[model samples]
Target: MLADALGQVPYFSAREVEALVAAWNKPITLRRGEYLVQHGQVERNLYFVKSGLLRIYYPTETEEICVGFAYAPNVVCSFPSFVHGTPSEYCIQALRQSELLGISKNDFAALLELLPNIARFWREELEKVLVGRIDREIDLLLAEPERRLERLLRRSPHIFQLVPKKYIASYLRMTPETLSRLR
Candidate 1:
């Protein structure tokens, strides 16, 4: 699974892949709805989802707003917090029972130092994530809620089956009733 995920990262050599495998520990499991990183806590490790799904969200005064999600075979972290060494403003939780492989931030940094290729791969991956965020932000700013939901479904139809309806509704910036009506 780790090798497959590494394949998604461009130009990762076999040795670099081996090094990453060595650095990441065995898979850890989280029960449904369990918090992986809570708001206001420092996220010390970056998780690679081996199975199941995780939601990244922030709590508003009225409710928890879903911001993003990590599906199987994808990396999940509170980016700003992880990069800056600060408490995360968002929480990461298991949307369902999940299996994850994790590498501590320190270990990841050491790996980057040891393998320059991995550093390049990391930069490219972060760039892609940034671009995706910008696109999502534009959608939020310009699209109607129903249009946003339609776009989301077009991009990730599997999300409807994998994630809870309420979270999906929040992620699309619509009420659950609105989501149901659209559906």
Candidate 2:
């Protein structure tokens, strides 16, 4: 699973990949609806999803705002909090029974120092995620609800099948009725 996930990134050497696999061999499991990282807690680890799905969200005055979803073969963490060692403002929860490989922040930092190629790969991956977040922000600001839903479907058509409609509606910044109408 890790090999497949890293196949697209060409920077890692065989040795570096081996080291990464060893370091990330710590396995974790989460049942559906279990919180992996809760708001107000310091996020100490970065998780790689081997299987299943995760939802990232934060509580608002009236409701929880769904910020994103992480599917298998993807990385899921409260990134800002993990990087800065601050309490997370968001929460990460398992949307389905999940299998994950985790590396603590300190261990990840040490691994980066030990393997420059892996560090480069990590940087590029984070950059891509940052760019995607910026693009999504632009979409949310400029697109109509229907347009937003259309774009999401185009990008991740399977999300409707994998995630609940209410969460999808929250992620799209729309009401459940609006999402139903769109469907």
Candidate 3:
């Protein structure tokens, strides 16, 4: 699984990947609706999903807005808090029964200490995620609701099928009624 995930990760050796996996605290299983990380909590761990989906959300004035999702072979966490040792403003929840390999901030730092190459990989991953977020923000600002929904579907078609329409509406910065009209 790690090999498949790292297929495009250059300079990563199989042995190094093994070492990284060995460093994880444990594999945890969560049921649907379970809170992986709660808002205002100090985020100290990163979860690598083995199977299932996780939703990253934040509370708006009156509702929860799902900002993103992580599926199998993806990593999910409130990265800023984990990296800075601060409380998270967002929450992550299991959207389905999930299995994850969890590594605490301390353990991950130790792994990076032992293998600086992994640190480089982590940094690169963060850059890619940030870029994607920026592109999404730009699209949302420039596009109409239907256009935005089309773009989102083009990028992540499965999300439309998996997540509820209400969450999707919030993510698209539209009201549920507007989303219904678009549909």
Candidate 4:
């Protein structure tokens, strides 16, 4: 199951992938509203989603803003915290009943040590995420809400059906009412 989840990245051989999967300490089950990692806490593990939804959000002085969303077969965590061992500035919360394969930082480092090819795959994944972030930022700056909504729909249709409108609006840097109006 884990192998299939990670199959999109071609650098991993079956044996190496299995070895990486085996490095995970355990599987964690989370219910709706449960936080896998709260803002300001050190991110200890990388969460490989087995099932369900996760919202990556952050709190402002007066509001909570949704930064992104992750579905099953996706990865959830504060990337900077995971990479730098700093406290996370983001929160990762399960949006529904969810199962995650939890790989600790130590184990992940060891896997990279043992199988260097895994490092290439990890880099590629991170690059993909970074590019997405950059694109989103550009869109937020240059596009109107309706244009943003259209672009989002083109890139990830059915996301509105899967994720709440408020969160989607927040991620797009628009008011929920504005998103609704645009729709």
Compare the candidates by lDDT and give the number of the best one.
Answer: 1
**Residue clash pairs of candidate 4:** none
Question: What lDDT score goes with residue 73 in model 2?
Answer: 84
Off by over 4 Å in 4: none
| RMSD of model 2 against the true structure | 1.5
lDDT of 1 by residue, 1-183 (tens): 988788666687789888998999857899998988889998889898999899999988889999999988888888889989899999999988999999999999999998999899888888988888887887798558888987788878888988889999999988999999999
Q: On lDDT, who's better, 3 or 4?
A: 4
> In terms of TM-score, which candidate is stronger, 2 or 3?
2
- Candidate 3, residues 1-183, lDDT tens digits: the string is 644675557888886677777776478898999988888898888888888888889977888878888887888889778878888989999988988888887888888888878989888988999888987987679658888888887878888777778878988989999999988
Candidate 1 yields a Cα-based lDDT of 0.88
**For every model shown, what is its TM-score relative to the native structure?**
0.92, 0.93, 0.87, 0.93
* lDDT, residue 90, candidate 3: 90
List ranges where model 1 is wrong by over 4 Å: 8-10
Which 10-residue window of candidate 1 scores lowest in summed lDDT?
4-13
RMSD of each: 1.6, 1.5, 2.2, 1.5
What range of 10 consecutive residues in model 3 has the weakest lDDT sum? 1-10
Model 3's lDDT to the true fold?
0.83
lDDT of each: 0.88, 0.87, 0.83, 0.84
lDDT of 4 by residue, 1-183 (tens): 677876666666777778877886479999999988988999878888888998998988987888888887887778889889899999889888888888888988888788878888777888999898887887788657888888889888978888988899998889999998888
Q: So what's the TM-score on candidate 3?
A: 0.87
Better of 2 and 4 by lDDT: 2
